[model samples]
Target: MARRGKKKGRPISGWLVLDKPVGMGSTEAVSKIKWLFQAEKAGHAGTLDPLASGMLPIALGEATKTVPYVQDGAKVYRFTVAWGEERSTDDLEGPVTKSSDQRPAEADVLLLMPKYTGVIMQTPPQFSAIKIAGERAYDLARDGATVDIPAREVEIGRLDLIDHNADRTIFEVECGKGTYVRSLARDMGRDLGCFGHIAELRRIEVEPFTQEDFVTIAELETARFGGQGDERSDSADTVPVDFDAIDALLVDTSAALDCLPQIAISDDAATKIRLGNPVIIRGRDAPVEAEEACATARGKLVAIGAIEQGMFKPKRVFAG
Candidate 1:
């Protein structure tokens, strides 16, 4: 469970490309950043486990509107499989459940790749965040319940072997939403007749944001107070808010809507869209035929909408 945030705070808005360090949960990271920025609202686009680290795009204030788009985008991960043992949770966090002395050759591991590639069915690890009847699956598993996670189809764009050794095999995979790399490692070991578990995992990319844009927590704090003189708050626990510095570190909300087709709307149209009304997209602004678009007015994002016979209807409107 995540800690509840304060109801009253500064209404800061924009995207923060965080280079999440290992051993920090995503929920805690959001809370820390929100407090550092003194933001009224904050949320993350994806949940990165504490054991794994890399790009974790945090949304402040109105930027939360774009979270769904980022979640649906493709993701890339690099992980290592430690063979000879399998954990109940499917990762290093879980207790060892099975083991085998047999090891599979690199060629044998490569041969199994095609079977798991493209669209395939996978059962999520028991110790996962997936909810079951309003309760988290991990909680259920910890309580000694047999969490029968169903097998569902997930998209795997690419899965390639980078390095292979007697005890560990390193690999990189590009996949879509709902695809669990832990499940892949577990299944791979089973296929090779040797038990295995994910030894280490790191996310290298998520759509609209990549490792190149990641900013470490220390880096963000440095940027916040680097040139602000000794203007620390009297409380010592609280940091003084610098709007100009915040605006510099944060990116516009439009940055996350890059996947959507862009459509430039008039100021009047933007106003109507904000009121939950449909606006007629101009001849040149809209794409030839797109179901959805990112409508902007003069350079500011207005709303994300659907195009029905050229009529752009607001689906998600941005208030900032």
Candidate 2:
């Protein structure tokens, strides 16, 4: 098989849609997968809380450069909010700080959904990875220091009330980057005159990917070792990455740019791009439209570029 990148552990490059299990922090999951693949480098597009489970896109090697694209894409999450008790961390991790017996009627909850849709300001959970003065917010919170996280604007595409009972409600949300479901749940409860916190959370989709593309860690291990009958991950480490399987199980870097405008360039242009030289782009005797686009050569990604005066200037070049 052709090598896709230089090997720190091995020349692996692609994205893995992991159905991240609950209780495993995002960073820990990244490290475990990196160790499993013996990959040179790896990073997740977005962080899923330890209490949250489901689709976590793991980008490997050169694919890491495109993570911002995936992270900024629309995300779909299905979560459960249990009313009556407020937790310090916003989810189940923290101790109960406040409680109430009041619960909103189903109609009241439905009536409140519209207020959350569209653009809104959300305060992220204090027990979060966000940096504050060079240290993690969670670190400070765990150290018993008071941490006050500021609210920021975020866009919500859709919010659906999936199911509900006396003490809890299930909801599904489609939102953009920087939206915090934990904060949403907390605020919703507050608006309803009852305290609340996330009881269960799962990310069903991230833009360019859906639950249909998700793979569990065990399934990944099995695929790597050809999934020998009845064997599990304990024995997976003994087996090496099937170079043949890597291409099948892993998605290419181009998948990350699915939302970007695309412009195909000539081999000569691609060559010049790799050499850090600018080339004029032409589409059917006319200059390519748009200020930014992903440039490709012979169906393979070349670089992300900008157009100015009809010249395509490579901003970030991809190595073969």
Candidate 3:
């Protein structure tokens, strides 16, 4: 029998919190990062529209296992809504579908904040990634088909009025998973009797990752090519790629599990976990039961599991 061939590229793993620039899609960003790192696998925590910018946590190789944790985490967005014209996509990228001469006053915007804050049902923009009977909503919208996308519950922890003018208003929001900033602007505008759409959106925080952790594409390129400054070097054809420097940019895979409770296991337990076996969690503070927890030994991630009656049952084991 012929043996299967080995996969190409480095088996590198970890998270790369990127400062994704506007006009680049999330999948494109992940692909670019994967190519730059020459990794065997890659994925992103969440999707950020092409018009949006800021921290986009990308997972490489073994780190891809933690993507769901980051995706379900809370996110914070700062956005500006341009009033007087509602667009098909809920952003400037779409064509105008409705118009209004009325502009919301700053006082009026403030008065409506309470309505948007806390748990609310939101219908996503038509040109969105949401699926309708297995097909993407954006694809259907592009084909000139309109679908009645139902509103779903989402929680907004806080919504503050940052600034406002006759034409636009800026807001900063802290929201849970699945919340749409575009919907917030659209709904707020409709309630205020002013048509509006998202003019700008930036995600500054995604749970454990924040603005400070972000590295731009230029920086990654510079690090890989040994550029003189922070900007990407134009001499890619001449300079050799620095794999070490590029690898340094990765955040540890365990970092994504910061939200979960952790248990320190012994070498024996680590060995058992690596082989897909459960082990007794031995510690005075060992949780008798937990739905989700991470196990570590000798400062390395062993497995992600749950504590059941003092036994750590492995769910997902890490290569490291």
User: Who wins the TM-score comparison?
Assistant: 3
Candidate 1 global CA lDDT score: 0.87
For model 1, how does the per-residue alpha-carbon lDDT over 1-320 read when each residue is reduced to its tens digit?
A: 99997457777778998888899999999998887787889999889999898889999998998889889999999999999999988889989999999998998999999998999999999999888888899999999998877899999999989999899999999999999999999999999999899999999899978877778887766666674533447542354544576557787889889988899888888989999999787876566457778999899999988888888898889884
- Per-residue lDDT of 24-134 in model 2, one digit per residue for the tens? 999999997787677889999999988899999999888898999999999999999999988989889889999999988899999999999999988888888878899
- lDDT (CA) for every model shown? 0.87, 0.86, 0.90
lDDT of 3 by residue, 25-44 (tens): 99999988887787889999
Task: List clashing residue pairs in candidate 2.
Answer: none
Off by over 4 Å in 2: 1-7, 228-241, 285-289
Write down the TM-score of every candidate.
Answer: 0.91, 0.91, 0.94
Clash totals for all candidate models: 0, 0, 0
lDDT of 3: 0.90
Regions of model 3 farther than 4 Å from truth: 1-7, 228-242
lDDT of 2 at 161: 96
Off by over 4 Å in 1: 1-7, 227-241
In model 1, which residue pairs have backbone atoms overlapping below 3 Å? none
lDDT, residue 69, model 1: 86
Error (Å) of candidate 2 at residue 250 is 1.1
